[model samples]
Target: MTARVPDAPPHRRQGFGAFVRARAANGALVVQPRMGFSDPGHMRAGLTATRAARAHTVGTVTLDSYTRVGDLDAVEPALRAGTPLNGYPIVTHPGATTRAVLDGVAGPDFPVQVRHGSSLPQHIFRRLIDLGLDATEGGPVSYCLPYGRTPLASSIAAWQECTELFSHARDLGAEPHLETFGGCMLGQLCPPSQLVAISVLEALFFRAHGCRSISVSYAQQTHPGQDTAAVFALRRLCAALLPDVDWHVVVYAYMGAYPVTEAGAYRVLREAAELAVRTGSERLIVKTVAESRRIPTVEENVAALEYAARAATDNTTTARDPGTDSQTYAEAQALVEAVLNLHSDLSRALVMAFERGYLDIPYCVHPDNRGLTRSRLDEEGRLCWAETGALPLGRLVHTGRRREVTAAGLLADLSYLRRKMDREAIGAPPGTELTGSA
Candidate 1:
């Protein structure tokens, strides 16, 4: 909501990447790049040209079929000495059927990450299948609508869309997990009241349907230059939004001039890490800092991450100290409220899920399109499906057990389940029995 003010304290204009390096106080240094200058060939050529050139030239590059043409495998070993690659393979393709094949090609440099999207919903699943083919493939992916409390009808519809997609994929013999986040992808972020409602749906609806991973794009929702307190407060709110799920916070630094100063953009990340710690979050995905500039060459990207790692230093925190002051709290609170109101408008999508008896778990396992999600509802039906015993997203055939996202809820639902095990614990017991609540 505000511009980044690195020099000013938290009370100031709250909120704040690429390619050149500079020195810091203790003989330390940093690097930032010129904007609009990320072409793969230009970058590669620049690498070849810079050593001999008499003058500087802003490199020019283009998307090689939308893929970066740099040889990251070759570049990484030399550049990343102390820093570790996320190791989560980001496979970029256009379909679902590739899942198996991709899964088949798994290796060391690329552990497993399925990055699929950029197509209409119909072909999305098929692309996923393809990804699955490779041994190195990760969760089959698709972009889903935003799951925030933005209250925008369009904002929340994707949940159902994904529920349906999951149903269709299941029938086709493709089982995949969705990538979820609090905001982005038409999803909404909201006040606690609204978040409560949304979380209920997140837990129950996702459970009833069949979703696995629920991600939180927390960085996208944060404002830069804001003091650490304010940043921490916003993170706390996000924590409140998804308390019951095994979620992750994606730390996206200022890849651009959206609202952060270079120093402030530098600062927002530490703020984010602090908040994540407060939330007791286990997983953290730090997006590349050089993204806003030209396409980072393998070395440059690695360098950018190295800088971020140092920038996000002193990351020792706990659940109690989310660490936000008053002004920061107010700013974060207001943002959540606006997003929550928008979520109300989007409730139609949530309600529709109830009416239809199922909702899509917008899990975008792919890192493509900056990690978006997609939902489906069989081969027909625009928004809603009119069939009996069928959910809005599509027909649901119990996966023999239950949905993934709701595993947490299932444990809660099984409050009585534990007691049954206890009561029948004579070394032999039944899977479903109740002695009380566990």
Candidate 2:
């Protein structure tokens, strides 16, 4: 037991899963992957593996923006082509009021591609309403788009775009939706006001836009010494505005991850689950493991979720008085103070990073988006385009610093984590105890 496993390879070599499991238990690493939101796509041979993950709850199934109905014809090719998170629902944009976006998984068919910089008739609203008649499977329906570039106007505009569509959907009896990687949703370079503004915007946007369903997201990432307080604030806000709207949280599982590496993602998992419970929303989306490093087979995706579900713990198990049930207000305040003190030390370092230029965001829209168009190669042997090739944003964030999360970095991560941890946003934390039945 003292010695390393005989044939352990370098990555798995440092120790075995047993070693990592021990570290995670000590609070050194956040174990138990929680609130997974995944978009599974790979070569033709990867379909069966995708279906296998039906066990874990999946919140968001990101898609290839260009995928259309015609692409699903080939069996092997179609498998490789992509599948829908739910059956691909028809999305429509009528008048200037509609801004349709595609997020979630593949297997889609759009009525027609709308060209940018092209003129459109105002009467398009009727066509859009007609198109959306049967788009949803009658469960719940919503919309999404890349968080646009430009700091001020764009962020607000993106928010407005959702409002318009949500209003349109309401006119026709459907809920409204909005989603994006956290950082991009707020402006990558904007101040905290912009970040805080996102929630406020969603609250107002959904109401004025006539939508009842609302969602917010953060990048799937964290650093050492996570700012648990900042995470708490974000969650509290969701609880404040959204007792009714749906909340979704997604965790990205990939290789070389920090939180996953240091704490094993369970720390964040519990946080997200806590938020979900506080918000009291019904469904939550969780991500799949085996996604950070390589193109996962469907089996690997399911295995990752199963592993997280099997290992996750519940952190909000404190006893509640039977007579006095709702302490939502008190709970919200407590979360804020808790996050502040917890992240006091960590926020400083990130502030410094912000002051300096170490963290420049090159990609404007979909900054942390990890959806790859397809797992393919191009001329001269290169991994698809650089954007699609290397680790995507979710992959990068989930893989936090290899070093321990300093109190400073923790603040930065917690800011995002707070938004990420809401239970409605993510989901209930998976059971911490092992199932013995994978």
Name the candidate that leads on lDDT: 1
Please give, for residues 1-438, the per-residue lDDT of candidate 1 as tens digits. 111111222331210000110111122212122211122223344333322222211121111212222233533443245332222112232234223323323222122223322222223334333434211011111122331222223323444554455534433222233333222222211112222223333433443454433433333222223323333453465455544433333333322222112333334344444544444332233333333343445454444334444543445544444344444354345434433443354344444443332332233222211221122222221111122122221222222332333445323432322232234343335454332222
Candidate 1 displacement at residue 10 in angstroms: 49
Error of 1 at 346 (Å): 9.0
Which regions of candidate 1 deviate over 4 angstroms? 1-111, 115-120, 133-161, 164-175, 185-208, 220-246, 254-270, 287-289, 310-313, 319-438
* Alpha carbon RMSD to native, model 2: 18.6
Angstrom error at residue 256, model 1: 5.9
List residue ranges in candidate 2 displaced over 4 A: 1-60, 65-162, 170-174, 180-197, 218-227, 239-285, 312-438
Model 2's lDDT to the true fold? 0.29
Per-residue lDDT of model 2, residues 6-95, tens digit only: 232234212112232233234222222221112322211232333334332322222222221212233234335554322221122122
* Alpha carbon deviation, residue 424, candidate 2 (Å): 29
Q: Could you give me the TM-score of model 1 versus the true structure? A: 0.39
C-alpha RMSD by candidate, in order: 23.3, 18.6
